[model samples]
Target: MEVKKKLLDLVRDKIRFKHYSYSTERTYIHWIKHYILFHHKKHPIEMGKIEIELYLTKLATNDRVAPTTQNQAFSALLFLYKEVLGLDISEWNIQALRAQERKHIPVVLTKEEVREVLQNIPSEYSLLVHLMYGCGLRMSEALNLRVKDIDFGFDKIYVWDSKSLKDRTIPLPQKLKAKLLEQVESVKLLHKQDLKDGYGNVFIPYALEKKYPRSKLEAKWQYLFPMKSISTDPRTKEKRRHHVMAQTLGRNIKVASQKANLNKRVTSHIFRHSYATHLLQAGIDLRSIQELLGHKSVETTMIYTHVVSEMNKAKVISPLDF
Candidate 1:
């Protein structure tokens, strides 16, 4: 007996086939499910351009979602109709909700402030914050790091399948070398204990798992920041050691911020932003920063220039002088 899959299930299959990130898959599925429910569960194949516009307009005019959130929903729908349903929505007029341009600069911590925040965080997770700032890694990138990704001899951190499906290498901070090595020893000890307990596998990327069935147990494949306990793999249903949760790191940062008496809205990403801004302030060229940050465009890297203290010094004229 052949059982048919639901529309959302088919959408999930398509997203997986395309190798989209898990976060993107979740976001797309959420918006698609919302769109379906908003339209009385009408199959997306039956809904066209007009339905999308109405939903987006409601989000802007009634729900008042921010521009970026609205844009994300729009992208999800676009993928659904074009990629999943094979419908041509390009010809249909899409009156998307216009979001106001973001004018505020990103919040960045000074060197002293970063030091204070790190001091306040628990020692177990402080290294993660250092990696975020030092290597310009996003929270996911830092947490997803494997044993082989950190090349201590070469002083490089290999970032894999980052945003935009791009892989990049960042300079490993010399100051962090000893601490990272210690951390690696800890992971090795944990892995050895797990293997002794008859569970030593780590989750590999979907395609890689299929290609190299034995790679999951390889020492180099273990997460650098493995979680404290083993868990069942959601996809494979086998108990494996997963990396530390981003939320745990985020919560620690919030606590550290309060303890440090910082006045800014701080998050894990703030470290990455501060990294770029600090590099720009140090006179690094925009092109080089772009490559280090894995930004596809130099323009994206240029945003840090606006927030660097050097720019403020050059651009702001004091009223007292006038």
Candidate 2:
């Protein structure tokens, strides 16, 4: 696993060129692994640019990966060539063999459908789903939520080091405020229990730990959804808690969706899509939604507008007709 280890380190180093979240770090690493495997485990240092191009071309034509996936592959390769191996990779204008995505709308759940889905979910998982819908949060954001981030008076949740490694705050739903307050009490109990047993210090990013040193014990630094117990931080060798895994939540939602008699392929992101669409449907402004979702560009928010327009399907008429 030497290559795997180096590959992981390479990914971390490469991400520093352009700031990306730990989530993106994980995703980039996965694609790099797949790319290496596709070439029958040939090392990137051994392969020339032409081989890299051909491999990517093969992925587009033969493997037929989706456009987003293909783009991610391109980015990973670009990073490998430009940063890791010191090679020039320029002008990727390649296209996937399949047609571009056009006029496609994201699958959205109705209010009743969302309610039923929540009802069908086992009680343990319901609160998480509520947070996802009630606040326009990506599942990872919800998973990484810490107890201190909840602001009961302001009805807001702080999201730090999100997908872009940038921090933003999204409002807490007024309806869910009561439940969140209760959850806060629950996290306090867990923290106290950890103290009594001598499970000292909290897990934070390796660099942050060295910088703040004492933040680990701070009440605000505790994970809103803390891990079951402290584990040795692989990077620092100190015991700390980390966020819950997204895959765990994904599996739980998948099984619950099936049991709820829903047929859609319900990944954790489907809830995020539903979040945007439902908010737009409820007469929330696009700019407001964009801010809440932490979108850097308004263009990203425009997609939800398309979803609503597609749903309405009203006919156009001349002024005379009016």
Candidate 3:
């Protein structure tokens, strides 16, 4: 038991050392633990490529996990062997039966549908939701926004170090400018109260925190959409105001979809898809949209073209209609 715990502790240390997010740390730990238990608590060092292949194959053939899920498990194990165990499994040439990936066309809402859904969303999340749709932000990017990232003077929003590992700028929505300013004022008030309570610190990356020790205490570094109350940081055990949880936003979106009585499913990413598709419909160039969405490849952004084509298929008359 001690050995297993120590191994996981080392993995945690490495992940933190690499500056991975807490969510990623939790997920990698989960897969690693599951891998060890599946082999009856055998130390990972004792197993080699064969054992790894067997486990992954079982996930596909028996457990029926999705391709991405299986790939994630594989990545965790690979990290364990190569990084933690100091073993080079690259030449092992383990061939496991891979799970099949399904092709999916993303669900998108029409402009009217988007309006109906946004109207049904709770007032508290209205601005955030609008920002997501307006600026084509992922839920994480929207929630992680800090006060300094918004450029009111320039009328742009700066997204830094996003999933694509690229920084991009988005044009601020004209309609939401007043609401956003009001939000910043509210955040300022909340920050003042937090400072008065001697708990104004927000989470900063370890390296940055060390470089600028007082940045965490600054109002501009605070989350744009902070939680209602301060909570203890899972890692540092410090009382800090973190942004709202993704789960809370997701739950509220689900409820709003129900209220709107939309026939199609609605998720946070749907807004992003709608954003891209709507842009394409407005004759925005694909390359420009790709930059706004922060896609690593233009190919990923091209999916919206197909979506627009499918939607426009109504204009074609079928033989039956003739």
Candidate 4:
């Protein structure tokens, strides 16, 4: 007789088979576990729409979860039922508590503020922050950059498999060109040393790893910002150097912000917001900014317009100026 797999293991298998990001898999698994435990360890197979609705309602009311949090939980459970358990929830009416839509503008730093924050951070992390603000890159996109992605001749950085799993190129900052080249040399030396120690493997995407078996050992395939220490790959268990962790960058930015005396909340993403807003202030059009930011919809990019509008209002000129 064959042994059946655990439900969460089955979920993990399906998630990986679909090529979902590890973060997404972790988040989905977390919510699924919470859902199961919330119902006193009841099997999800025995639960249906009503059980899901009750769980979601508890998240909203008793747990005081935000609407988006509740929705994420719902999505996780939905995936569990439809994909893992092979259940049809199409016609089920889920009367769960809904979170109110928020309209708060994103926090953006002024040019001077951005510079101040950069000045306070270490040189290495400052470069990362610079890329985020200068190129409007997400933290992950910046960290995941490979040596081959930087094109000096074209004067652009190729951002592959970004937030929406789409690719785009942004102009490299002219000021950072020399620094980037220097960093490349440093990476080459590090890679050489790593290879000398017989531990130079880097993680490649699944499809590419299959297509180019030896690419992982190539210099061009090496991470631009490799982690200081090697780690075990969660899936393969092979020891390799991954990209710098996003949390490290986040913490560095937080420390820099505090040191810079910034009263506003600062995070890695604030650089991206500042990038978009500064471009709009410089008379760049929304469509172009949208493309630079790799936003799927111009509508999603319109939020920066609000930020700029608020800035403009602060500088209002009265008729007394005449």
| lDDT of all predictions | 0.87, 0.76, 0.94, 0.88
Alpha carbon deviation, residue 27, candidate 4 (Å): 0.9
Ranking by lDDT: 3, 4, 1, 2
**Error at 2, model 3, angstroms:** 1.7
lDDT (tens digit, per residue) of candidate 1 on 167-240 = 99999999999999999888888898899999999888889999999998888899999888888865458998
Using lDDT as the measure, the top candidate is: 3
Clashes of each: 0, 4, 0, 0
Per-model TM-score, in order, reads 0.92, 0.82, 0.98, 0.94
Q: After superposition, how far is residue 87 of candidate 4 from its true place, in Å?
A: 2.0
Query: Which stretches of candidate 1 lie above 4 Å from their native place?
Result: 1-5, 309-322
Q: What's the lDDT of the predicted structure labeled candidate 1?
A: 0.87
How far off is residue 186 in model 2, in Å?
1.3
Return the top candidate by TM-score: 3
| Total clashes for model 2 | 4
Off by over 4 Å in 3: none
The per-residue C-alpha lDDT of model 4 at residue 253 equals 94
Looking at model 4, the pairs that clash are none
For 1-322, candidate 4 gives per-residue lDDT tens digits of 0112388889999999888889999999999989888887888878787898888888877888887788888889878888888886766888877766578899999999999999998877777788788899999999999999999999999999788767899999999899899888888889899899899989888899999999999988899988888899888899888988999999999999999999999999899999999999999999999999989999999999999989889898888995
The sequence of per-residue lDDT tens digits that candidate 3 reaches over residues 152-243 is 99999999899999999999999999999999989989999999998999998789999999999999999999999899999889998999
